[model samples]
Target chain A: LAKTTQPISMDSYEGQEVNITCSHNNIATNDYITWYQQFPSQGPRFIIQGYKTKVTNEVASLFIPADRKSSTLSLPRVSLSDTAVYYCLVAGGSYIPTFGRGTSLIVHP
Target chain B: GAGVSQSPRYKVAKRGQDVALRCDPISGHVSLFWYQQALGQGPEFLTYFQNEAQLDKSGLPSDRFFAERPEGSVSTLKIQRTQQEDSAVYLCASSPPLAGASNEQFFGPGTRLTVL
Candidate 1:
């Protein structure tokens, strides 16, 4: 099972692009990196997912290097409402998809 | 379309009390999952069901924690003799059966269980 590690917390100004990186050095070959955003009192929402290279959606972009050991979640032009916890998960291994403490992003205006 | 919905929104139970949490997944969803999220922690996978069959339940903390999806759409997670350690937000998620693709799981607002 691969374990993910990320910054405990981060602060960014509004209207700036925010990038949070997660490291999963022991990720397996079949594991795919997925990112989720969670707000207070709600469940986590899927942000972006990718296996290699980059994957972008309307909300965010996920950049995964070739080695697949690390991935970055980029939120363009973050707003105060973007403040939340972001989790990076490595799925597809024998272990169930688990979540770490995640990086708490605080977007300040 | 309606996303996953959990019943009661919040639950407060005394220690040793039994409580049942409900989940209604999106229509036609083939997969359902349950998770436990404690304060200042990320959600932890509890169990997973593919339609009517429960495929994985290794994450269940103990025998007191039980879950069932009899008809394949609605699920119920029952905690017997609840402990303070079980106090947390119980989340339910579902994903479509996208063959060979890693389908994104949609989550519910979750039922916050506070065992005092």
Candidate 2:
């Protein structure tokens, strides 16, 4: 499993764009970058996933650089409800998904 | 369509007692996973099952932890001799066949266990 490093926490205001970056220097060739959001008293929900370059969905966008050493989760027009802990995982092939401590994002009104 | 479901949303157990948690994956999902999440921490993998076969149990904390998916639909996690450290939320997730390791997982609300 590839170890990921991210900020402990981040703060943003309503309508602001939030970007959280994760570093996985040991990422394997087949590993895909996946992000998940977890709220209080709830299970983690999948946000977005990408193998390289960029992938966008209705909720968020995943940006993976050419080297694939790092990835960023970009949230547009953040709202108070977006406050949650975000986890980054690199998994593929036979490797099981491993979650790190995650970055807690607090969206202020 | 229904998603993953877990029973016993909350449980309080005394130390040294045994406890069981159950999970129902989405219909036709072939991959089931069990995870443990502590307060203010990300979930940790406990085990994985492919259909009726137990594929990985390496993440289980100790011998006290056991899990099974006998019929390839419903799964159960059993913890014997629970300790205070065992207090955490047990989550279950499932993925469709051919989803592999990187696919998105549908998660249940989870069972919160508090061991006194």
Candidate 3:
């Protein structure tokens, strides 16, 4: 499993774009980047995933550079509801995964 | 329920007692997984089942923890002789297992187990 590195917390204002970056310097070639959002008392929800380059979904965007050494999760027009802990999943081969402490994004009014 | 469902949303167990938690995966999901989440920490993989077969259980902390997905849909996690450290949120996720691809996992609300 590829160990992930991310900030412990970040602050963002409402209607602003919030970006959280994750560093996986040793990410495997077969590995993919996935992001999950979790609020209090709720299971983490899948936000977006990407193998390389830029991938956009209805909720967020994931940008992975060519080397795949790092990736960024971009949330556009953030709202109070978007405040949650965001986890980056750097999956390796096989059936298991390693999840590290995610970056908690606090959206303030 | 349309999504993955876990019963007894909250469970408080005393030390040395046994506790059983249930999970119902999505209608057609072929893969199920169990995870343990400690306070302020990300979820840790506990086990994984492909249909009715338990493929990997290396993540389970000890033999005291047992999980079964007999029919491949509904599963149960039984923790015997619970300890204070057993207190945590147990999460269940299900997805379709594919070859050489990333299967997005759909998670349940989770069962918060507190052992006193």
Candidate 4:
């Protein structure tokens, strides 16, 4: 399993865009980057995933550079309700997913 | 269609008592996992089951913790002689068979256990 490093917390204002970056220097060739959002007392929900390049979904977008050692999760037009903890994981092939101390995003009014 | 579900959303156990937590995974999900989350910390993997087989249990903290998935659908995690350190939220997640790919895991609300 590859270890990931991300910001402990971030602050954003409503209607503003937010980007959280994760670093996985030991990422493997077969690994895929995934991001999850977790609300208070709730399970982590899948936000976006990508292997390389960019992948966009209805909720968020994921950008992966060519090296695949780092990935970014971009959330457009943040809202107060969007405040939550975000987790980034690198897993694939036979690797089991692991969650690190996620980045806590606080969307201020 | 229902997602994963767990019973007894909250449990308060006295020290030295035994407790059991139940999890009902999403229908047709082939992979089931158990995780323990302490307050102010990220979740930690506990065990995993592929169908009726327990593929990995190396994450289990101690021998006192046991988990079983008999029919490959519902699972039960039992803890014997609960201690204060056992107080945490137990999360259950299920995912479809990936066939060597990475799949999104659907999680339950988790069982909050407080040992007093």
Candidate 5:
């Protein structure tokens, strides 16, 4: 399992675009980037995932550079409800995934 | 279909007491996982079970913590002699068959355990 590093906290206004970046310099060949969002008292919800380049979904977008050293999660038109702790995980096929202290994004109205 | 579900949304135990947390995975799911989340921290993997077989428990904090998934469906995590540090949220997650490690994992609302 590769270790992940992300900002401790970020603040964004409603209707703005928020990008959270994660760094995993030791990412392996089979490692994939996944993002999850957790609100207070709720389980973390899957947001987006990507292996390389960009992957977009109805909720968010994930961008991975060619080096795979880092990844970014983009949330567009954010609302106050989007305020939550976002986790970036790098995992491979073996099923062992580790989570670090995530980035807490505060979306203010 | 219903997503994962957990029992005892909140539990408060005196120090040294035992507590059991339950998790019900989605129907027909093949993988179940237990995680511990401290306040302001992300969920930490505690154990994993592929069906009824507990494949990995290396993340379990100590022998006091035990988990079992019998019949490959409902799973239970038991904590013995709970300490203040054990006061955290226990999360249960399940993934569909053939889902990759990075695949979406359905999570339950979680069991909030408070050890006083």
Candidate 6:
């Protein structure tokens, strides 16, 4: 399992872009960076996933550096309703995926 | 037929009591998983099943925890002798588990168990 580290919390104003970065120094070659968002009392929802470079979806975008040691999740045009906990998981190998401590992004109006 | 569903959205149990949390994954999903999440912490994997066959259960905290997927569509996680520390949300997720592919797992709303 690749251990990941991310900020404990972050703040963003509505309409602004927020980027949360996660570091996984021991990430494997086949590992892909995936992000999930969790609101209180609910299970985490898939946000975006990427193997390399850039990947964008209707909800968010994922940017992976050339080294793959770290990746960033960029939420465009943040809103107060976007306040939630974000998790970054490096998934690969036959090992079951594990979610580590995630970053809490509070989008303020 | 719809998204994943879990029964008994909230469960309150006494110490040493037994509890069962159920999960209904999406139709024809080949992979099923159980997870336990403590307050203010990320969820931890508990066990996994592939097409009704138990695969990895090393994540189960102890013998008190048991899970089964008899029909490959629904799964149940039973915890015996519940302890106060067992108070947490129990989550279920499912995926296609396609070989040579990294599949996305859809998660259910989870059963919140409060061991009083």
Best by TM-score: 2
Q: Can you write out model 2's per-residue Cα lDDT over A1-109, one digit (the tens) per residue? A: 7889999999999999999999999999988899999999998999999999999999999999999999999999999999999999999965479898999999999
- What pairs collide in candidate 4? none
Please provide, for model 1 over A21-51, each residue's C-alpha lDDT reduced to its tens digit, 9 standing for 90 to 100.
9999998898888899999999999888899
lDDT for each residue of candidate 1 in B1-116, tens digit (9 for 90 to 100): 57999998999999999999999999999989999999999999899998989988998999999999999999999999999999999999998875122558899999999999
TM-score of each: 0.96, 0.98, 0.97, 0.98, 0.97, 0.97
TM-score of chain A of each: 0.97, 0.98, 0.97, 0.97, 0.97, 0.96
DockQ of each: 0.60, 0.78, 0.64, 0.67, 0.79, 0.61
3 versus 5: better DockQ goes to: 5
Of candidates 6 and 2, the better by lDDT: 2
Clashing pairs in 6: none
- Higher-lDDT candidate among 2 and 4? 2
lDDT of 4 by residue, B1-116 (tens): 58999988999999999999999999899999899999978888899899989998988999999999999999999999999999999999999876232788898999999999
B3-100: candidate 5 lDDT, tens digit per residue:
89999999999999999999999999999999999998889999999999999999899999999998999999999999999999999999999755
> Ten consecutive residues with minimal summed lDDT in candidate 3 chain A?
A90-99
Candidate 3, true inter-chain contacts retained: 0.58
All models, RMSD in angstroms:
1.4, 0.8, 1.2, 1.0, 1.0, 1.2
Candidate with best lDDT: 2
User: Would you give me the overall lDDT of model 6?
Assistant: 0.90
Q: What interface RMSD does candidate 5 have?
A: 1.2
lDDT of 4 at B39: 90
Residue pairs in candidate 1 whose N, alpha carbon or C atoms collide under 3 angstroms: none
